[model samples]
Target: MEYVVSHIPQGTACNRRSAYKMIPTTITIHNTGNPSSTARNERDWLTNPSNARQASFHIVVDERQAIECIPLIENAWHAGDGSGVNSGNRTSIGIEICESGNYAKTLDNAAELVAKMLKERGWGTDRLRRHFDWSGKICPRLMYDGGNWTGWKTFVASVDAKLKPKEDVRMPEEVAVQVDGKKVGVGEIKDGVTKVPVRLVAEAFGANVLWDAKTRTVNITKKEAV
Candidate 1:
């Protein structure tokens, strides 16, 4: 999938240099619980840095539209600790179907988008289950307390009906370079080192290069680029 940089709030940050190196086997659905529009939710995650709760998920379908937050390759902090373990945060992708403050149409879209996500991910109905199944919490209440689990079931069933193994897809170019940090992009790697160009080296990180053709010496400045 293509990575697009949008308006990310300041608070949303990752704790590590690389994405959580685990392929998620679960999907977690959540409710914002505070009822927020798509923009509001994004803002809250970004601007409220002090809250110390920074995370993202694969997708969020809300009043505005389905937002692609944390890229599919990275981990998002959407799962919360319940009972004992944090099941939904990193090892599982999260979908926040906003149900707070009055916005509700997102429910239908959330269901549809989830089905699409499941199909795309090649996860079958057997792998599909509610977050409560893992943590025993009343979240995404409409799916729990509202007594209409049919939506979730229908989505899973659709996934199962068309289950087929996806072809062995080649890893994306970005996966090999180990540049999951902010603002880093895919580039060629040579001799166990990605030889960034003298001119473009600055783009990767804080570094200055002085190319002395006579001495074959290239001075590089090192610091955080972004």
Candidate 2:
């Protein structure tokens, strides 16, 4: 879940932070569409003013790592929704998954990152949207073209699985009881109760333990201190 933050400058033309604010109600996922660029390269390209004018996103994820190009609280011109008040650019956090390197691993990293964002924003998997959802463009083109939209569903499932709570596991430990600095028989915890043999404990404490067969009872006696 570790990510690199190489945020774009505050007043960069690519990210107009003063014009609009972002509340991040939704997470929009995209694919870089470049077959040879890594997340770092994408971040660098977005940071450059010459390349920043066209489009920008909050983060770019690859197989090995993720890089943040823009702050999540500000809008990046990624959604291609044009100039609208409720455009995805203004209300969503955009993430571009790099197509370079191991495609499957990159997708997994993106899913993990998105799952964390969902948990932080208190959003569900329902809030996950594809670039194609906002506009007719076939972004994350690999998932759409390769799996015929089924891949997107599987990705959402991965994010949902990550959000699930994990079960707690407890291992039993052997409990030991000591008397007068001497080791005695081991005790055990069962059904939330500690069980130990009374005779063993009494004998370990230098007490005389006797069994009465007639009444079926056990007795212990310790000598008084001199």
Candidate 3:
């Protein structure tokens, strides 16, 4: 859950100078499209004001870690939506998954980071969207080229698995037995069954405990009341 922050300062085309607040309603996923670009490279590119050309995303994820370029509170020019009040840029957080070396690991890291964001925002898988969802751009091209378009459901399932509550394990309790105002034997309650030492209980009650030699049985005897 660690992220390297290399914020893209304001007053650039990628990041607007004015502070624009947004209540993230959706999580948009994208691919860097460049095969050789790593997460750090993308972050650094976004940080450079000279490279700010109306292209930026909140986070870029790679095999090793995720990098934050734009603040979540502001709008990133990632989605292909035009310069208007588009939901993709105004109300959604964009995440660019790097398709550099070890893309499988990069995908896993992106899924984990997205799942963490969903948990923190108290959102569900329904809020997840691909770049294609916002516009007709074939972004995250690997998903389509690798025939992984259907795998989007699998990714969402991974996020849901992360959100599942852990099962509670209950332990057994110890039971104490007392005879004549004195504790005589200790028992354990496990799996709804109680186990105690018969000899200890008999001895506490002044009964003689004997083992039969022939029948292989335990016998307890005490003076009978007349």
Candidate 4:
């Protein structure tokens, strides 16, 4: 889930392609479309001075590693949408999944990166958008799965599964309770907190329990120290 920073150097080309700052509101995924290029290869091409295409991406991922060629805070030209207020290029973090190597692993890696970005920005899976979603371009073609929505759903489901919070199982079931290594009673978990019968626990600790009938309350006072 980590990446190497290889930011595109500031230049006329870089400026023209991704000079504008972006408060990324969404994430866009793409497949490099070049099936034999590695992520480093894609990053090199994107950052190369000879490359004049108005196309760049924030990140590139292959089976081995992920490389970041553009800052996420800046806009990249991966999304073909124009620079309007709602343009995907202006408000989306673009990730190009390289198709060179182990394609399935690359997809899983891309899903991992997408899930991380969503989690970091507090975005839901709904914020995930494909290149096609923005400009009708069948990108990340593997995920496109012959233009089937089910294919996209499969990838989205992976990200969604990663986004779900880990379980905080405070108490699985009633557990044996003990006072000073001696069994006293059982404790039950309620709302992440464990509850134990006060009478048993108090008496186990050498405390006297008194019931106040006037207020219908029970109070326990220590009978001895230690």
Top lDDT model: 4
Better of 1 and 4 by TM-score: 4
Compute the lDDT of residue 195 as modeled in candidate 3.
Answer: 85
List ranges where model 3 is wrong by over 4 Å: 13-18, 48-52, 145-148, 169-226
Which sections of candidate 2 miss by over 4 Å? Answer: 13-19, 49-53, 172-226
State the lDDT at 223 in candidate 4.
Answer: 87
At residue 135, candidate 1 shows an lDDT of 62
Which of the numbered candidates is closest to the native, going by highest TM-score? 2
* Cα RMSD for candidates in order: 22.1, 8.3, 6.3, 9.6
Tens-place lDDT per residue, model 2, 66-142, is 88877788888888998577998888888999998899999899999999889987889999989998987887687
Local lDDT at 78 for model 1? 61
lDDT measured at residue 116 in model 4 versus the true structure, 0 to 100: 88
Q: Which ten residues in a row have the lowest lDDT in candidate 3?
A: 11-20
Better of 3 and 4 by lDDT: 4
Which should have the higher TM-score, number 2 or number 3? 2
Which candidate do you rate higher for lDDT, 1 or 2?
A: 2
**Model 2 residue 103 lDDT score:** 93
Range of the 10 consecutive residues with the lowest summed lDDT in candidate 1? 1-10
